[model samples]
Target: MSLAGNRATMQSGIGMIEVLVAIVIMVFAMFALISMQIVALRYQKTAHLRSMASQFSADLADRMRGNIRGAHDGAYNLSRQRYPALGDPAPSCPGPGSCTSQELAAKDIHEWRTGLGNAMVGGWGEIAGSVADGFTVKVYFLDMLAAADGATPVARNCQPTAADPVLHREVSCYAAVVSP
Candidate 1:
């Protein structure tokens, strides 16, 4: 073949190789974008679940602070395994009612449980300790924690690291110790 003809054939092959390389790069870029989008969605769900748990803990804290009698009398103490029945009626303690502080505390727990059940997936909560040494309120709900035991201590970690394969896991405990 003539020298010019050989050069033209080589140049065409080079151009096709370059085009194939560009297509490969674009495919990798699209994959990276899709992976980032999935990661963002998981993080958003985690943020929402954590916020709900924080709210639940704060609610019990406010309730205990408002009722000093109940806090001191041990009426506010609830263990992790115990949960108020869902359908149980709240006590008849309307305004000007003669119900004792302890009675009102029971009603408060019932209502709080109802709220948690409605707002969270598999929600559970407890109030431990007393006014003498302070109080702890723990709320358990479904989240994306990698590790958790039911009724974990306040010092334990509630959310697990994402390195583990446990995506979309549940945390069974969260605690807030309060002194009123």
Candidate 2:
């Protein structure tokens, strides 16, 4: 073959190789971008779930505080009892000083839990073990009101319930100042 023809053939071969290499690099880059997009989507989903959990927690905490503040003597109670296929009765506030402090506290707790359970049933709040996915709120009260010791009697401390099945392990807590 003529020298010019041979050189042209070699140049075409190099061009084909360069095109193939570029295609290969482009394929790998596309795959990497796709993987990164998938990771970003997953992170977005997790953030959404966390936000929902926070909203639910905040609502529950606010309601509990209201109930506690409205209770007599700033002493309230909550129960974790679940009835067998039946709902507990609504709470009735006894006349002032009619019930013992312990009884009043128990009644308050029952009322709080009853309100939470009702919310769950109404689809306004999540319940533990009701679904495989989602979150639950567990309510807890301080052993004693710190404000009882010369502080304002209207002050209260509330904490989220412990970790359990079907609920996230993280807990959130808050304090409420009851209006006299």
Candidate 3:
């Protein structure tokens, strides 16, 4: 019963609800992408910190091996509390002025500690095992990668205990134990 002109006047178009739904879906997708990016960055930082810790420990161990006498004489044994300062000198042996294994070891410690401080955030190294029974250099760092609770482990001898769950906030501390 309607005329041809009247039928042509009814236009086909998108509804408001459909547009809103599309916008909501796009917003969710964007949020998910952002979340994934954040997690990936966190894990990447953790891996980097781990790599630095292992490499530093290995370097110290190699230095220790080069001076077996110093290793045995407790020259390379550094306690948790006392560390080599930045201004410490490291002299080489078998050159113009001969240096003892002890002097070489001192240089190694100073350089190693300086590297640790430079490479990591609040990074530090300690000797867990004694020279007689071999040695384990435990590298400690404030793991900024993970979101921690309230009471993180402080740097101490044989510290960062064997506990898994972190009780501290701000930062979760991690320790990499490397043997020499």
Worst 10 residues of 2 by lDDT: 122-131
In candidate 1, where is summed lDDT lowest over 10 consecutive residues? Answer: 159-168
Cα error of candidate 3 at position 97, Å: 6.2
* lDDT (10s digit) by residue, model 2, range 1-180: 558766655633357778899999999999999999987876674445445435555654454444443343434322343222125464565675675654554465455555544533211222232112222343322212222244321122222233221232222222322221
Superior by TM-score: candidate 2 or candidate 3? 3
Tell me the TM-score of each prediction against the true structure.
0.73, 0.42, 0.73
Estimate the TM-score for candidate 2.
0.42
User: How would you order the candidates by TM-score, starting with the best?
Assistant: 1, 3, 2
lDDT of 1 at 87: 70
Writing each residue's lDDT as its tens digit, candidate 3 over 1-180 gives 759879787967988999999999999999999999998988898788878887888898898888777788888766544422344555555562476877888777777877888888766666655566777676666675444423443432235443223342323333444434
Shift in Å, residue 19, candidate 1: 2.3
Candidate 3 similarity to native, TM-score: 0.73
**Which candidate number would show the highest lDDT if scored against the true structure?**
1
lDDT of 2 at 136: 38
Q: Residue 164 lDDT in model 3?
A: 29
